[model samples]
Target: METATIHDERTEEGRRLTLHGRLTVRVIEDISPRLREMEDDPVPLTLDLGGMKRVDTTGAWVLYRLVEHRTEQGFITELTGLTPRIEALMAQVGKANQMTTIRHPIRKRHFHLLARIGAWVEGGIYQFGTFLAFLGLTMLALVRALMHPRRLRWLAILRQAEVVGVSALGIVGLMSFLVGIVIAQQGAVQLRQFGAEVFVINLVGRITFRELGVLMTAIMVAGRSGSAFAAQIGSMKLAEEVDAMRTIGMPPIEVLVIPRLIATTIAMPLLAFYGAIMAIVGGTLISWLQLGIPPAIFILRLQEVVPLTDVLVGLIKAPVFGIIIAVTGCFHGMQVEGSAEAVGEKTTAAVVQSIFLVIVLDAFFAIFFTALGWA
Candidate 1:
């Protein structure tokens, strides 16, 4: 517990800090302020440690920092007359500090486009690998549930269905309705120029049934239900509830993910069909007001022009889109780690990735249906 002292002297050569007494914790604590004053001094510093009776890790670290700081600033710092033991202690401290002291990655001066692209591709590959693993885990859970139907949580599926489908009807219907109106108005205007304004009925019916209906519902569900899944599961992750379930021999995929997957998958086609109906109603209203078509005639024309094939196409894609949304949300949710901030980040990622994947799937379906002569 011996206290150390620093003797600061300035000469024509440089500044000198001479240590006296034992250089330990108490002494370092007391001399810290005095040590800091030397930081801005650009002149050479000579640390004379020979007078020190003893030194410890704390003392060695402080002295090493002073030397390192001055050296980094392009100023000279010399340690003179150190005993072999103290010199050895200082060397060990220097190595330890270099290993972990305020470690940060040094930024590169310039990165080429190819380097950035390579990094992006590497990250994407890693992400895809993780997603495939998650998919496999989910499939295993599905198989387990199929093998033992009693283990399946039907109540949870019903609850999630209400949340994902029933609760979402209002917004989906409203958005689809508004979108339908826009499609009708725009179609009527453009077709009017060619003396084919009545064709707007065909335009609205085919577009709603074939594409916009299910696609809009999927987008809405991705933003709403997808984000909710990520946030809900991610919060459980942060709370360690997921881990606790695992500790208790409960597989999270079977308990948490499968119910949601079933609910969304079943609810999506029904929701899409309902949304398409609402959109057709909206188009009907617009046709009456803007096109001078009676509701009766509009319905009759819509029935004649739009085939059952379009409805089948939309419904076929809906369940797949639903599966995409549920998997992305739950996958990203389970991926959350560290702090609460990660929950929000993964939630956003869930929504964005779900929407992006949904659009990509939609495009693929469009091409597929066209090749099958459905278009």
Candidate 2:
């Protein structure tokens, strides 16, 4: 590779800087200070690139900066004798640098607290609108799939069901079981003071089946399957597979989102029921071992005290929770941009949003059910 050289010539019209040999990183490093100095010159400047043997982004950037600086200072700066390829490369680099420079001005401004708060509110409103739009599109996709069952992807739905439901069983069961034991032990300690230790079974059954069972299961699914959905879809997006599907006349929601949503909705009620059963078993074991209540007695008390309606209440919430988790995950996944960091960021957002929405919906259900005298 030829070493780059810069030769400056001063004429009546302007100062011209002729670049020779390879205009690359090493050459740019050597000539950067010289280019900076040229920017301060009062005369108009012209850069002659015809003598350059090669050019890359870094070299083009240095030249772009010099031209921008000179122009900003009211000096006419021009490029002369450039081939089509180098001119195109320089134009591309110049545009990118301009965007970066434009962003810097915004960062330099001091934002007041009120201004920041207003900006946040504005962003929230925009995001809410976007989410509503997404929801509408998903609903349309669902309708289309229903009308044309042949468009439904049964294989994908089954695969996602296994992933979102069957695989999550062990962790959901263990979490509920441990939570049940804690509730029983605490209740036993408190009830013993009142000489009602056996009431632990009633407390566990009521709380687990009516509230904690479905709530805890939803949260666990949000953290596990929701995050997985985000990561999977985000990776596909990053690979341009989602765009490719669209280019090929495939609806992404139908191909990707519907299967996961349907599977999760189908699976959650079953998981919630399983978790409730596990929780009851754990409470019963603790009652038998610690409270000295026989297993038979515990079972009899649970049957007598806890109504079937209580169990049904929890199961009723499961499908709604599933829809929230699946939709939130898939929504954030589709929002991911073109980078690895974006994928990770959106995945985190999906889990957080899913869990937050699940809890919020649970609260609404609690209120509505209580108002209806179901609680």
Per lDDT, the best of the predicted structures is 1
Q: What TM-scores do the predictions have? A: 0.76, 0.73
- lDDT by residue (100-212, candidate 2, tens digit) is 43443443235666688889999989987988898889989989899999999999999999999999999999999998889999999999999998778889999999999
C-alpha positional error of residue 31 in candidate 2 after TM-score superposition, expressed in Å: 16
lDDT of 1 by residue, 1-375 (tens): 668878889989898889899877766778877887787789888889878898888888877777788888998889997998887888999877744568687656565666788899999999989998998888888888989999999999999999999999999999999999999999988999999989989999999999999999999999999999999999999999999999999999999999999999999999999999999999999989988999999999998999999999999999999999999999999999999999999999999999999999999999999999999
Which candidate wins on TM-score? 1
User: Which regions of candidate 1 are displaced past 4 Å?
Assistant: 1-114
Give candidate 2 misplaced runs (Cα > 4 Å): 1-111
